[model samples]
Target chain A: MTLTKRIIPCLDVKNGRVVKGLNFESIKDAGDPVELAAKYSNEGADELVFLDITASDEQRATIKELVRKVASVINIPFTVGGGVKSIDDARNILLNGADKVGVNTAAIKNPPIITELMTLFGRQCIVVAIDAKRNYDLKENVNIFSENEKKFWFEVFIFGGKQGTGIDAIFWAKEAEKLGAGEILLTSIDADGTKNGYDVLLTKSIVDNACIPVIASGGCGKPDDMVEIFEKSNVDAALAASIFHYETHGVKGVKSFLKEKKIPVRL
Target chain B: MVSVAIFDYGAGNIFSLKNSLEQAGASVDVITSFDKPNIYSGLLLPGVGNFDPAIKSINENSKTKFQDFVEEDTPVLGICLGMEMFFEKSEEGIEKGFNVIDGEIVVLPSTMKVPHMGWNNLEIKKPGTILEGVDDGSWVYFIHSYRAKPKFDDVITAESDYGVKVPAVVEKNNFFGTQFHPEKSGDIGKIMIQNFLNVCKK
Candidate 1:
């Protein structure tokens, strides 16, 4: 049975503070991860995902501690990602009470990470995160373009969305699923901070092709954006950082809005 | 005391199933060894992961005690792989099941997706006591590739459409099975669980 998941509030943590930006740039301190997670949980957020935006390996201990703190007060399922590059890292996060571990760079670099994690922690514990940007071109038959291009469709990005892998986003999502990823967390680079709305077309491409749960991230300006994704795309959850961080919309607000739109959400 | 013994072979969603049972007001005891099934009012066999390994583990740990419990008319509930284990044999592995139900576990047709993971509506075939308050169209969460095809169609209590009549819920006296994850199906799932607990009470 396909019961819809409630809204999810994502917190990008760097050096123990919540930050938000487009394509992982122009960062601003949001707040404490523990405090923000608690607020959202109290406001009826169904789940919370924490991504440590830093690339340094030293932040591993800090992220694990952060996961332990957040898991203590938050009863809902929480997923921790960012800088998780190995099976031991995934184990430590799960041991710290994280329900799932999100892998992006590691999964891209080593496609076998999904199978290894699933073998150790089970399929439900592994989630593959995709950070994608539109790759468009004015020239005929060119579906992709370099970062210097003026018009682009959606190009897959890695390493905190700073480097383009030049791989098709749809192909990557499908490969990740085939590799035993239980769920796919799709973050649109184009809609990362515009608040205009999620790139519904980009989301549809991944969600339609993949059988696993696809989380719609980036470009969430209002509750209506969530409704549009749920109504139009096959996305299971709508993830946003700025809206929930800035208190533009609480978990309850989005749940009520989705419920009114005939979308199922846990009240 | 309404204690429900959850057989944990380290292969399934044991914690979530225990939590759901607890939420339904049933005291849940996760039993790793099948030495004593008589102590609990009911038993839950929840399975995840591969088939052969799961069957081997169950046999090595609690097969004798489980068979004895079923013989004594103890209420037992199986979910997903657990339901598949209730059949006579499985195609994934050469091993035979507990034979609690007259069926065989076969791989789903290749026409549909391998793992049918999603929410689909349940079509109530023969509404048993365990499905008392559940509406026919109520949806449940499912995640599995292999399913049991029972020789007796009357054994099916509820079925879901996934290119074929996938058995959503099955029953034969005290033995019950759910192909869907009732623990993850939210309120309706809780309701179905509560109904199963009611059967145990009788």
Candidate 2:
């Protein structure tokens, strides 16, 4: 047997509640972070990631409380991301009990923090989250991918995918790994929220270049979508949001389907 | 409830281990060193922090009594870095290990990735160790850069093939160890944790 590919259920948290901007009565108690975490952990999710979208000062303590509650209940690997800028921020999250911390905008603005976090926390616990958008305005000396008579390169974006950094995502991924990041969390802004599927080209490009494990985030709508990404790219894990949060598919059902299709997964 | 304790390295998180241990039916305590007389029915060396600092902490915390626990029949469960420190020395750091078992720690082969950080299946070489109920080829969570190089090959009960014969489970007398973090390893890990606690009860 080989190292199985992971399936991660990502929950968007705002002020300590799992937020999706969409009403899903399917969720028990409507966005109780602790409940959803334990549910996913028991549903055969390989891991769980919570993207803290809350930006207030109170969010710091609230996120820690949610983390502690989630940690107390779930027995799976959990990662908390968003607005982690300094070592103190990471320590607060980790000491309260997060297995890993994912940094996106902050690491893009100041890349040295990746090394710093890795030095303070073990590399295994520091995951550098990269938000990338497809820039069809192909430029010189950038990794490019083409599909359906169109050629484009991925451009890195920061600040919840609202700001463009003008840096190539592929190059930045390698640079982050070089700077001692243990893993890379790659999210495709182009494919996100669009149920079509993940940006296979973007995921494959990053996985091919990254020696560290890569988690493909955004644009996974079904088990088939996961099968497509895993079949086309050797991504170590796949992260999904609304599809799971809204009960479109259960984590165990998705893994069973993938297993039937010959993808190794923990059952 | 039978009592168990985890020796904290002063750095890194042990909440998961502590919580999982509690779920596995034991009262868990976080200890710095073996200063107090051994009240624990079982002991755990958590898989976190760097080797040098962790060993330094372990050294500071009453090695003579801790060594007595290892020499006697107090089941000790070491995970990842916890398992690595049982050897004489490690390539990751300058400090030496407890020399509990005759071996040393070294980095994964250069051909493979430095940190084999993910889920891998164990190829059980010898059974009836701490992994008594564990099935062969069972998947578990692992996150480590260095591996054990034991002087006695028979000490290894199971190993994972990560382009190298990476030892997964090991046992010498009542002392036991796993290179993977069973706390994060889902159902299979639960079985191993339960089995370790069972040994403690015995």
Candidate 3:
């Protein structure tokens, strides 16, 4: 059947607690990860993503526990990410009840991990998460493609956005897709936690190049923001943390608003 | 209690499917072999792997058991990749399917996204027990790249629109298959699981 646009609520969790961050820093506790996950699932959320923001060794055990608890209560598909460094780590998360495992920092450390996870668990379960930030300065010699004529192009980041990969975000998306990634979770580091709006220009660039589904994250302040991304870009899904976590607008409210805008959402 | 033998093909996640079956009031058992298909009232072939590898596992493990299970009039429900295996073959792989039904699995058009992920409404073509009480456009969770295309028109119970008309549900005699995961489709999913269990009770 024709796939409908998805509304996803991202829970950046630390030590089993849901947290929110501004530009990938200044993390603050929001609530329990399991509680929020269950709430989102029941409130008509199309999908849920639980990212263990701080991938510390000590918190690894708790992430698995959180996935198990969340999987038991929710009927919707949910994905788990953060600190997944190996195939065993991905396997443990899926076994513990995560429908998919997101790879960002670990994938950056080793690009082959994307293919490894895809081969072992199937592509549908491997989401290659890319945290990208805008870099305006560019030399005339270096050739890089951007959908927009804007001088700045997005750069990929690693280690929870603390380290830069110097890799072009659009180029990496195509690479990840060729490596058998099921979907691309594209988050704009500049727009993250700002609650302004999504980087429709950035989203459009990648969605045009990548063949798989792309879930646009960051800068989702209002339901109109989601509508704007859908209307402006070809993104398959939209994810936000602050607006949903703080009850700025619940999942149902966002879907209802999108439905009224003539957007195809499962309400 | 309706006992269901869930065929463990050594791939994909069965936790949710098993958990959903238990919650829907059925006794579930994860069986590696198809040796005792008659002991259970129903058989469930849940999958999440490539067609070739999955068929290899089934052929190497319990090929005859599945045929026996179906011949005995035991209710069978296949989900996602499991449903795709019901057909004669698939474009995704070279391995032939179980050939239980007259159909083949074809990939969704390249015009639309490959893996039609997320929830979409089901357009009921012909209502059956599996879709009993389910709304005509009820949303169900789906994450599949290929969908079944049955040979006979009457076999398609329901369809969903992507870029093309993707077959959502198919039923032929005692065999039933769903392209979407009923275990992950929320309340609608739970109800479909319960209905499958009810079919076993009959």
Best by TM-score: 3
Kindly provide the TM-score of model 2 when superposed on the true structure, using C-alpha atoms.
0.93
Over the stretch A156-267, how does candidate 1's per-residue lDDT look in tens digits? 7888888987777888888898888988899988888898999888898888888777889999999988888888976788898888888787788878888898897766
User: Interface RMSD of the predictions, in order shown?
Assistant: 4.9, 1.4, 1.7
* Per-model DockQ against the true two-chain complex: 0.18, 0.62, 0.65
Q: Global lDDT of each model?
A: 0.78, 0.85, 0.86
A220-250 per-residue lDDT for model 3 (tens digits): 8899999999999989999998889888899
Runs off by more than 4 Å, candidate 2: A21-30, A138-140, A148-151, B60-71
Q: Each model's TM-score, in the order given?
A: 0.77, 0.93, 0.95
User: Tens-digit lDDT track for model 1 on B1-202?
Assistant: 4778887666433555666687678998877677663777788887555667777777787656468765756788888878888889988778778888898988777776555655678888877866888988886667677788999998998998877889889998888899987775656777878888887787
Candidate 2 lDDT by residue in tens digits, A2-37: 678899999988777777632211222237889899
Q: Write the per-residue lDDT of candidate 3 for residues B1-202, one digit (tens) a residue.
A: 8899888776657777888898878898888776554688898988576788777877787656468666848889999988998899999889998888898899888988878888888999987889999989999988988988888878888998888888889888888899999989999999899999998999
How close to the true structure is residue A89 of candidate 3, measured as C-alpha lDDT?
Answer: 88
Against the native chain B, what TM-score does each candidate's chain B reach? 0.94, 0.95, 0.96
| lDDT of candidate 2 over B133-196, digit per residue (tens) | 8889888888888899999999999999888899888899877989999999888888989999
Using DockQ, rank the candidates from best to worst. Answer: 3, 2, 1
